[model samples]
Target: MTLYNNVFETVRMIEKEKLDIRTITMGISLMDCIDSSGDKSRQRIYDKITGYAQNLVKVGDQIEMEYGIPIINKRIAVTPISLIASASGEDNYLEFAKTLDKAAKEVGVNFIGGFSALVQKGFANGDRILIDSIPQALSETERVCSSVNIASTKAGINMDAVKLMGKIVKDTAYLTRDRDSLGCAKLVIFANAVDDNPFMAGAFHGVGEPEVVVNVGVSGPGVVKCAMEKVKGEPLHVVAENIKKTAFKITRAGQLIGNEVSNRLGVPFGILDLSLAPTPEIGDSVARILEEMGLEACGTHGTTAALAMLNDAVKKGGIMASSSVGGLSGAFIPVSEDEGMISAVQNGALTFDKLEAMTSVCSVGLDMIAVPGDTKESTISAIIADEAAIGVINNKTTAVRIIPVHGKDVGDTAEFGGLLGYMPIMALNKFSSEAFINRGGRIPAPIHSFKN
Candidate 1:
């Protein structure tokens, strides 16, 4: 009866709540694909990715059908292209991006990541080339997503990369202006970026990772919010306990799906990322989970404290349920992706500064936010710098996926469509960070980061 009750409850969670496997990402290493000839290298990359991930989407669909679990996306993450393409001595990496896009389409994955460079401390030869190509690469490719790690806890922050990324972001927005700067939505700027993350646009197969592996991302924000409602008048400790238990259940389901997918593909199962990633749908929100914890609104005065508790509880529960828990394993608070977050921003309950504070506890940083079209590049860089500092000092991964939608402003909304959703343009400080950003150099690692 106990086993029967658990199975019944899980089924109910999937049916009534928006419980789902967010993505089953196949991480493919491209190190062996490198060649002296750029054409040859691209061909190798194309063959390797399509070959490894060809059965990925099909396997994901099969699992969803068999287990009655919703698998929202089937995706792929590859080794950073900078390392792979540098061997070819290519001045431009545009072809590399196109090859990835083509391969992703061939395999039918929703998104293909790792058009990336890791320059947390400084730029390598290939890192600069890849960074230079990002504007055109993202603007030209349909499925290719890009990321640049400009800061880390040990290596500190690369102010040069930070400053350059500001311009790169603006250029991407301008190039994709026909689609409301949709290209910027596919780009992420990071600090302490992890390798095994199954979610994009920050997902990449790290050098240390196995040649081919399967990573899973699971989400159940609506299930969590529903659980919170059950203990409406409960104490904070009680609320925390309930969240932990719910997270354990969610993570278990994710691991089951992940292991099955890995087995079917004949690849090792990687970590299960149990992030409570939200969608545009109502009742599916991290903000609502926080609000259900007795807050008047999502971004009220005690929001950060609530978020800290929630993040900690979720991690604790996930760790208990799965030994292979990795990736960004906490709650994600992307404004465009969460209906509750969008409502909070529109009602003036959430502000840009509050979002920054929230990132200190949440999974990622300043994700899927759309700022005014006229916002200055230096100001955007400054925003990245601030988020980087938080991640570096705290030794946690943080990323910025802000989009400055072309011809849009505070009173307007930018429609990105699908899971990318839509968001109102949020206001930013008019004060300039130009002079600060112009003082380009690396910010030294924190004192704590010096420990061996």
Candidate 2:
């Protein structure tokens, strides 16, 4: 009877609260595909990815139908292109990005990540080449996503990479201006990036990861929000407990889907990322969860405290549900992706500063936000620096995915269809950070970093 009741409850959550398997991401290592010739390397990569992921979408669809679960995406992540393409001594990696895009299309995945570089401490020759090619690569490829890890808790922040990314972002914006500078939407700059993240535009197959693995990302902000409504006027502790229980249920469901997918593909199960990723849908918003906690708006005075408790409870509950829980296992606050966040920004209830502050307690940082096209590159770099400092000091994974929509400004809307959503361009400070960003050097790791 109890098992039947639980199944019925889960069905209700799926029908009414938007519970979903956000993605089943297959991570493939390209380390073995490197060659002295760029063409050979590209061919090997294309063949490996398509061969491994050929049945990924088919299997995902089968499980979704068999179990009546909604799997939103079937995606792929590969070893950082910089590490593989560097062996070819290529001056540019545009063809590599195209190869990834082609492989993704062949496999029927929505996106393919890991056109990436890791230069937290310093640059490798391939890192510079990959970074240089990012703007053109992103502009030309329809499905290639890119990232750069420029900071880490132990390695500190790489300001040179940060500065370069700002200009790269601007160039991407210029190249894709016809599409509201959508190229910037596919790029992420990170601090303390995770090895097993199943989400994009920051998901990459770390060198330490297995040859091939299947990782699942689960999302249910609406489920948690609905649960919170049940305990309205209850003490904060009760709210926290309810959220944990809901999260536990969500995580368990995710593990079932993940294990099934892994077995079908003959790949190892990587991890279950139970992050409360939001969408532009009305009920499926993380900001709505915070508002349900008694705040008048999502960015009010107690917003950070509420978010801190919410993030902690979600992690605790997910940990209890599965030992394989990993990735950014907390609430995400991407502005354009969450309808409630977009409303809050338009109502003046949420400011850009408040969004940055909230990121200190949530999952990722400055995601899917649009700034004015005329905003200086130095300002964008400074924003990345601030978020990196927060992540480094706190020993957490944080990232920036801000978009400067060409010819768009405050009060203007940038349309990025589908799950990417749309947003009103938010205002930025007018002050210049040119002199500060010009000082290209590393910021040393925190004092507590030397735990060895």
TM-score of every candidate relative to the true structure: 0.99, 0.99
Model 1, 301-385: lDDT tens digits are 9999999999999999899899699999998988999999999998999999999999998888999999998889999999999
lDDT of 2 by residue, 252-307 (tens): 99999998998988999999999999999989999999999999998989999999
Would you list the C-alpha lDDT of every candidate in the order shown?
0.94, 0.95
Which stretches of candidate 2 lie above 4 Å from their native place? none
lDDT of 2 at 112: 97
User: Where in model 1 is the C-alpha error above 4 Å?
Assistant: none
Clashes of each: 0, 0
TM-score of model 1 relative to the true fold?
0.99
Candidate 1 worst ten-residue window by lDDT = 291-300
